[model samples]
Target: MSSWNSLWKWGSVALLAYVIVRGFSTPLQPGLVESSPSRLAPGKHALTLQAVGQPFAEPDAESADFSLILRSGKELVRTDITAITPHSVEADVIIPEAVPSPAMDAFLFTPEAGTLFLGNAFFVEDAAVGPLPADLRAEAPTEVAPDLGFSFPYQPTIVESIRNLLWHVPMWFAMFFVMGIGFVASLAQLRTGLVKWDLRAEAAVRTGLVFGILGLATGSLWARFTWGAWWVSDPQLNGALVTVLLYSGYRVLRAALGEDERVGRIAAVYNVFAFVMLVILLMVLPRYTESLHPGKDGNPGFNSYDLDNSLRAVFYPAVIGWGALCYWMYTLRLRMNRVEHHLLTR
Candidate 1:
């Protein structure tokens, strides 16, 4: 038992170490990060687009083979590449008097890199005409084979911050995993009237709270970079905050009922209720309403495209490793509670 426990503990540490090193070090695939003058006017316009991650155009690659396309509904309007750099490109796009759609999505077909996409990149407004005539529209781009390499998908808004998915998301998952254990333990305490179950429940809540707080902090940092705010009014974000606050009340309830013989039973009941609210607020409510947060109503999550096989390789280990570490903390706290109880009775 001792040998197996040691193996599990160290295995978690090693897996977390691997996740940290690989998660941070991996490069993102090439994609457009920003474009100057997001709104384009009718007629010929000079545009510059900045790129993040790997180089889109190869050093030896010719400009003739590369193409920039703007999708206005079904019509593909081609752009003339004026100049190309490793990290940025300048182009001359001739916007028709009118387009099929006002919002244009950009796609860069590169020889070295795959087709990079930026949805709603440039908005066409106040054009001289309505939709472009079919005869005036450009040809669709030729298909180019993607450069198959191990890298995270480059998201337009998320970009390098996509790496946070490995840390922020898994922390919440691990917290929920441990907190579920506490909820079950609390139920057992209420049924059996056992102090041991109460201790286990308390330890689990304390350990789970640590990860919960970390999840919020990491999520806040991620939001600051991507959403330009430390916090948002989004339902999912608020739900997470409320869930943490509710669990925190569990500890306060235990402290308030000190030395009472029924303290364990009362706190156990509170914890059971708290876990139910956790599911209702964090899981159920977020799905029903519209949210800026991904995986919610109308918004396709990172899992749809961003969480590829390369990310999963590091991500799965992170969840397991963090979960193991959380359980280890619970066990330590449970032993401490047992020791304290023995001392008080003596």
Candidate 2:
């Protein structure tokens, strides 16, 4: 058992080191970053598109093979490429008088980079004529297999910020894991009135709160980049803040009671109630409301198609590594609490 325990402790450290190095170092997949003249009008329009991450097209590569497509509803409008550079492309797109939808999505199909998509990239307005005839519409390009390399997926607004997934998300998972432990310990304390269980419950709360605070900080930083704000009024964001504040009250309760004999039982009961509120606020309420946050409402979460195989390879280890580390902190705090109690009594 001792050998197994030591192996896990050291293994957690190794896994965390790997997550930090690999997660930060991985490159994002090639993607179209921006387009000049985001709005479009009917007629011949010259456009410039800038790209980031890996190069999509070779300098000497033929521009004829690369296709730029604008999708409006079921219609696919093709564009003529005038120039192709390593990191940008120039295209001339003809817009007809009428279209199915005003909002158009853009896709760049290349031999090397697969398909790069930007949703709602261009808007069409004031087209006086009807949709382009079927014969003029370009055929969809052949699908290219994505390059299997160690890289993060490129999402439009997310870009390199997607790397935060490894840090911000796993911290919350770790907090939940340790907080659950504390909840269970609180229950056991209430049942048996044991001082050890109370100590464990208190330590777990303290340690889990540390990760919870980290989670909030990392999430806010990610939001600043993606949402263009340090904080948003979104349901998931508010719920997480409320849950953390609720758990924080647990610490205040412990401090107020001081050395009272009833402190253990009262704290245990409060911890139980706080855990229940954590579930309601963080888990239940967010799902039912409209939220800009992923995994809520109709938004697809990391658990869905967003978390591809490459991300999963690093993400799962991060979850386990952070959980183990948080639990280790809980154990150390529990021991310290026990020592303090003994010294005070003697």
Candidate 3:
């Protein structure tokens, strides 16, 4: 039985690694490339295009060839062709170099000859380009391209980053979740004076703290790229720190009162208090107070839109994969505790 359990434990680790790698390596969504611009600069600008999709045979890099068109006042001033990678494209257009006496319209054309007209956008100059209208702003374009909805600015790299969402956030979530269970166990120990509950609580907290540290490390790396900060003083971030510290203090309590059975019960009571504080500080406080973190303030967090259909394919699997792995770890720790207790009693 023990050998079977050990094999399963090792298997969980392997499965987690596979999920992480595949989630990151796979492209966001594989299909034809659609042409879209992050923003359009008016007047004497270059309209560039590049390939973006599963690379066609030969050269492996030029995934697709693209066509571009710029029109002003019903006249097509320029038409060009270019190639791009799977994620980004640059197009150049010389918009007459001379300002239109009266403002003109801007437009783009794809190889399929579909027209994308930008309304009165020609007035936006390089020196004073106001924010693009919400319509023109860069987002996952709603209009599915003729080629089965694949479009320009498609980032396969983002799929890899999505793994971080599962590996990182869930670690903290599972940590807090397990620690909360431990906290309950601890309370039971104090109430009933049961050594068994104390042992369970100790093992859960130790395992939970390991996950907590992993969460912090991973979260810090992710934040650096996404938010341009390794750490922020936001409510959510601070709350997480507080929670970790609270558990660490429980360890201190155990050490400080070594050899005292009553001390274990007392420490268990404290752990319960800490868990309640963790919920209030991390969950409740962040919602009520303004936080720089997404999902707390007006800023958005991961959702269907953020994880897109393409990303969800791997992300959901990653969550399940990592959760399973963490559970495997928990079971090992529990078994070890049981063995140690048996020896001591024997």
Candidate 4:
């Protein structure tokens, strides 16, 4: 027990250090601004340019010369942007001088900051010119573009660094992992009819539910920023809620059956059933149903796409650290359960 405690202590410190270093090193997604003349009165039209992203908070002095290219049909018409604010700029288009009706493509760049192509499509049309042209017919690849130059949003404080990912998805993984242990322990109790295994199973489930609730709360907060909703009735979201409720019901069953020897076996059976349902409901159903959740329905999963390589370096460490911390909590609960069992018998 002493050795395990020592190992956990050292492991936690190392994991935390790793999460902090990587968080600072990681580059967040760059913000984008798209502006164009969707409709025009057949005269000079202006397309505005804007800088976005967390970095925009401290605008780069070198960004004063930001340029945007406006492509009319197959030709590049406008090549320079008039900087208004560090975050915004304007591009003037001489109507007929550029193109009769421009099927536009907007591109922006700074001296040190590399290029960014706005994904939002825009066009200009005139009564004289028919449908302009679909010169660029290919889909814009929706992936993180290489940032030739950028900086972190905030100074990488140790807590903020590790907490970014820890404060997001690690809780879910920790909850899932602990609950999975309970599922297996419950199965063992069912097979051997052992009270010891039942106690372990109960402890694991109880600890897991705590993390599960935290995961949901954290996820809801992150969702508000990224998905624009506190809670959306999406597939993955609904699936997670159902899984949490199912486990809550497991505890309810155990409580209602106070002092019954059969309670353990019955709850064990139900744990196995609930776990199976959890997999099906949270994992399978979300993929089949349309979801606004970042990870499902063609949206980027937490790390696969949305999180860049930089984020991954910190995120994976946060998972390990949080997992270690959760295990610590589980061990404490398991010991408490054993103590309670002995007292009840005595």
Candidate 5:
């Protein structure tokens, strides 16, 4: 039983090591991130496109092996590749005199990295809406899905910051796990008025705060990368901040009422209240309001769209490993609390 009990410690250490190594080490699928001269007129012009993530072309890739196409409503306007590199492409594009729509989408066909695309990349202002001329049309090359090895999915805004899902989300999960323990221990303290139960609640809260702070820090970093702000005024984000603050009050309440005869009972009741508020702030309130978080009413979730198998392989392990580490910390704090209480009472 002792060996079995110790197994999770090693397991969590190993799993966290795997998550860190795999999550940061993986690259993203190659994609076109930006375009030059977004506003174009109906005429021949030079166009340049910038790319990110994995390399889009080989070191010695030929211009003939690349193709650039534009979609204007129903018409496909093919362009000529003037120059190409591993990271960018230059094209001499002929804007059709008449296209079905003014908004154009660009598709770059690489010899190996499949079809890279950007929606509404160009807008033609002085163009008429109609069928594209035959001279501007060309059949696009077949998509060659390159074996990109193991990599994270490429999101338009998220890009490299997508890796934070492994850290920010798992830290919150770990906080919730240990805080749930504090909730149960609080209930037990109230039911039996036991000193042990009070100690357990205090320890759980103390440990949970560590993960809660980590969650907030990591979440802020991801927000800075994706949202261009360190903090946003969204419902989900505000709720998370409030929840962390409330948990912090649990620690303050215990410290202020230090050594009182009613400290255990009073602290347990406060913990119960704080836990209830945590549920509302982080879970219930976000669902009823407009939230920027995925799976909320307005936003599309990542899991259904872009969170692929590569992400799942590391994400699940990250959740389990972080939860185990949180619990281990809680148990250590609980033991230390019991030792201190015994010494003080003697």
Candidate 6:
């Protein structure tokens, strides 16, 4: 156990360093973000599609190397690529007078980027709701083996915000770990009425609160960019904040009552109550109520599709790194508490 303890501090430093370097540096996969002149009519109109992700083109790129096709229902509209760049492509497409669907989806097939598709890109105006004309059909490019280098997945709403998974998720996990320690230490303090146990419990709670606050900050940042709001009315999100506030009261309670056996016992009891409230608010309420937070009801989460092996390679290490750091912080706080206790007693 002592050897493991000695190694974990070094482990925390090494793993956390790796997560910081890899998480921020990895590039994102190529994806289509916006289309210029989204509203179109039945005529030869020029269209430009804007892309945001890893560069999808080479310096020596040609129009022939790319294929731009527009879809309205089951029909595909032919388009001629007039120009291509690393970030965008310009195309000329003729929308037939009659089309099955008003909303058109665009598909850009490139040799380097493979394929980039944007749904509801263009809405047709002054066009009859009928089958697309036979003359508008176009063949898509054949699949080619393009070497898209190591990159993160490009989600429509969460393009770059996906990187927050490392900081936001692991910090929450670390908070849970630290709070669990506090809960168990509080139980031990209540049973034995030991000063050392009380010190440990207080340190754990103090360290846990730091992790919780970080979780809230990182989550807020993610919501701001991806959901377009810093704070929103969601069951799980509010539950998380309420739980953190409940834990915050523990520190406030300790500060109000100074050092004493009776006060320590009272604080331990309050600690137990706070931990229970944490579970109920964060775990129980979320299970029954509707939530807009990801991985909850009415919302989708980042699963294997979003968290590919490349992410797992770094994410797992991040969880371990953050958790170990939390433990190390708790130990430092506990030792400081012990020293202060000894000095006061002497």
Top TM-score model: 5
Tens-place lDDT per residue, model 6, 155-271, is: 888888788988999999999999999999999999999988889999999999999999999999999998899999887788889878988888788878865448788889999
Model 4 misplaced regions, further than 4 Å: 13-29, 34-41, 54-65, 72-75, 97-103, 121-166, 298-307
Full-model lDDT, candidate 3: 0.60
**lDDT scores for all predictions?**
0.85, 0.86, 0.60, 0.68, 0.86, 0.86
Cα lDDT of model 4 by residue, 1-346, tens digit: 8897789867976997877665556554344454644554445667665546434333356644455665555555443344446456566655442353445666665443455566433565554554333442223223334454334332111212323454557888888899899999999998899999999889889988998899888878766756667898888888889988999999999999999979889999999999999889877888888876556774435524334444555667788987887888888899999999999989
> Which 10-residue span in candidate 2 carries the lowest summed lDDT?
298-307
Residue lDDT tens for model 2, 1-346: 9999889899999999999999888877889988888888888899888898876646445336678898988789988888888788889998887877888888888777788887888888886545666755989978988873878877877888887888998999999998999999999999999998999999999998999999999999999999999999988889889888988999999999998999999999999999998988888888888888877775436545355777888888998999899988988999999999899888
lDDT of 2 at 277: 87
* Stretches > 4 Å off in candidate 1: 40-43, 61-63, 95-102, 123-126, 130-137, 298-302
What's the lDDT for candidate 6?
A: 0.86
In the range 143-188, model 3's lDDT, one tens digit per residue, is 3253423222233223234457657866876787678779888888
Clashing pairs in 1: none
- For model 6, name the residue pairs that clash: none
> Candidate 5 vs. truth: CA RMSD?
2.1
- The digit string of per-residue lDDT tens for model 5 on 265-326 reads 99999999999988888878887898777767744354552458888999999999999988
Flag regions of model 5 displaced more than 4 Å.
Answer: 59-65, 298-302
What are the TM-scores, per candidate, against the unseen true structure? Answer: 0.90, 0.91, 0.69, 0.79, 0.94, 0.93
Model 2 clash pairs are: 97-129, 98-130
Model 2 misplaced stretches (Cα beyond 4 Å): 59-63, 96-102, 133-136, 298-305
Q: What range of 10 consecutive residues in model 4 has the weakest lDDT sum?
A: 153-162
How high a TM-score does candidate 1 get? 0.90
